[model samples]
Target: FVSMACSSSSFPLMVSISGVRGIACRSITPELIVKYVAAFAYLQITRHQKDLPITEKPEIVLLRDSRVSGEWIERISAGVLQSMGANVLSCGIQPTPTAQLLALQRSNAVGALVITSSHNPKEWNGLKFIDSDGLFLSPESCDVLFQMVNNSAYQYPSFEQRGSFVDFADAAQIHIDTCTSLSYIDLEATKKRNFKVVLDSVNGAGGPIMKSLLETLGCKVIGLNLEPTGVFAHTPEPVPENLGQLCSAVVEHSADFGIAVDPDVDRCVLIDETGKPLGEEYTLALAVKFYLSATEKRGPICKNLSSSRVCDDIAKEYNCISYNTPVGEIHVAKKMVELNAIIGGEGNGGVMLPDVHIGRDALVAATLIVQLLSGFEGTISEYKKSLPQYQIVKLKAPIGNMVPELILADMKKKWEGKEGVTLTEGDGLRIDTSDYWVHMRKSNTEPIIRVIGEHQSEEEARKVCEQFMSEIQNWKAETSE
Candidate 1:
């Protein structure tokens, strides 16, 4: 089965198993989808190079978000996966992190298929594969998946041996329970405060559980986009400009604070009682603070290359360490496994703890936020007032698929000998200086090159990113001409 649609622009820029995302149709076709899933089934079933486990039939967890097409595509994937002798547990229309956590808790499931394109538009959808360990499939697994897809070595189970599907709505509740079980929470204190809360789910899968978690924490909840209808009122990315509804509702209802989760709810950003956006980076930063301070059992923290250096400050207080990995949850998760990290996440507002599985969980993050607010007994604004401050300017522009590598090369050459420039090759090119850092990365989900700069002031951050962006753009144009 030749797939003519698999090209640089059309094919998904698949990362490790958990992050294969891109625009729909162009990136993921029906045939390609089935073959890849079947290939995954092949790899999981064959993972035991030793004697196969007693569970002759491998089990898989199948889940999706609120995207209307999620059901159709998931049904197709289940058919192919089931055909390959993989029993499927359906946690229908769930958040991405929920699927991963459920896969971890279910003794029978060996992997999970999470259908989401995250913050991408409605026309887009994706498949994120998670292993039995609840971590996204490793880099090696993806290589094997693509090869297996091309090899046609997939073994389809016989009629009687074929696997079956079961409806497991309880999976979400199980996930919620596991998250609450983490030692970080003081539910007595949180419930005693009786905080007021407002939330914008962006009409995504987060609606089902984000509000539920808040209510369970004793928050007086006012929720927008709670219907789970996928009729997005904003871009669904939780950026400040797009967060007007959440902020306004916070003030209108006079809520203690407001929260925003992207479509899948794996990431969360915040707004204060004043209706002022705390932005995404602070979500991770606060989580780190609460996580590190919660117990004396401090360990190295893991963070992404594109994230703020606030973790550096937080780590200093504990005399613990921080390891910066590539800008993806899997990379951070791998490092966490290596370092036994206490907490870690991306600046996109995702937080992962070893207590739970390795994934960005909005519910866990929200729980941390509430705990912080409870511990301090102040508004979100007051709690954030004491943290170290830096202004990060985020920018991006279109670049051809081939240009990113060239731009990275030029950046290294151009900034290498500069007195202030120090470089780290984590994801792409992270050029550091005495007081700031700039990272230019090729986005896994989009065609644009993302340029991020953090400095003491917004003006300085802008200057850094603009200079780098201009130099790269001009260099690429000249090379093409």
Candidate 2:
């Protein structure tokens, strides 16, 4: 019998197409980073070898957020890729989506690696892999790559065959230029507004890029945590509760609105002119309104099942169709690709525009929101009030030792015949009714089951969430007993 101790059991490491995430130096050590980065490069070389030209060397773009551990991870990644005979294009401390966009521009690029943990705590840092097409890897690709990592199947070239490195520091400029040149962005109109705006990047990757983009649009910027020092001003998620400083700053500066991005700058949340957060969900909702209104081609809009139904409402208003997949930005992105969705994203401030890269882009979201505001007659608060109002209550409970399958089955039986109730079980259990919907899913990044309920009224949403929370608590207690 063999007994092996695991030192990282307490700090769980998560591996998915999104990337590997865990506590730095614990589950996500330098050694692990090198292994995974090598695995990624190997998979790309192996899978895409036939498509490559013999004379062209496979190139990869590497980027990182402002997390303190990012530089060390970047060094390990660069070493692994170079050792494996791939050319590296290093775009230091850029937004997650910027890495993806830059990948598409490289003719010989096979993939890109972004070192970021998004909204995770300061202690956590990770990587997100972008394919040559500038999209996150699909589940099938991820599965194959994981097998390679497990088997330690990676190539190490001879000294003479080692790859070369190039400093590609202009990713931020490329992103801004691309966003500004998009037909939807009213550059002249945005500039004429001369809008005063406050930006809080949480000392992550978004600060410089967002400031540059907003300034180009002629907004007077009052920036907070503009330095990408990795020392976060507060909790880094950009949720309403975590954005009190931004809210206060918005009012203090008399800015038109305040924008906040998570550590990696993919998700964007907004604070209104009146010092009220528009909620992360509104970021996508308003962008949908703008994008759909501007585009002539009417197509289906894609969103995750757990995303706000406001997306559906907007699509319906445009006389377009709306479709949903399971949770995760990749799911939404893939669905958008399949359906050729003109606009879509998750409720957590992710805006996926096929016109810009397929990944969730906070920069794109901010640009689109400003375009929407440019044509509007009132403040963001008033504009928000014009839309359909839905209250979403989110809660999480520890999974403990309970079997999620049994709990889901029980939930299905209990709500099976109830009028106006519908059940879904793919990504955990989701119960939908005419006016309210509740989705309970085991979090991919955390050890808890997230319960979310949305209704037209705050009271009803709260009630629905509480009911489900209580049920889960009861079931967990019974299982432990």
Q: Score every model by TM-score.
A: 0.94, 0.97
**Candidate 1, 272: how far from true, in Å?**
1.1
Residue pair clashes in candidate 2: none
Name the weakest run of 10 consecutive residues (lDDT summed) in model 2.
Answer: 1-10
lDDT of each: 0.81, 0.86
Q: Put down candidate 2 lDDT per residue, 15-52, tens digits, no spaces.
A: 76566788898888988888889899988866665668
Q: In model 2, where do residues sit more than 4 Å from their true spots?
A: 1-9
Question: How much is the lDDT of residue 232 in candidate 1?
Answer: 75
**What TM-score would you give candidate 2 relative to the actual structure?**
0.97
Q: Estimate, for each residue in 261-340, the C-alpha lDDT of model 1 and write its tens digit.
A: 99888999999989999868899999888887787787889989999888788888889888899876778898899888
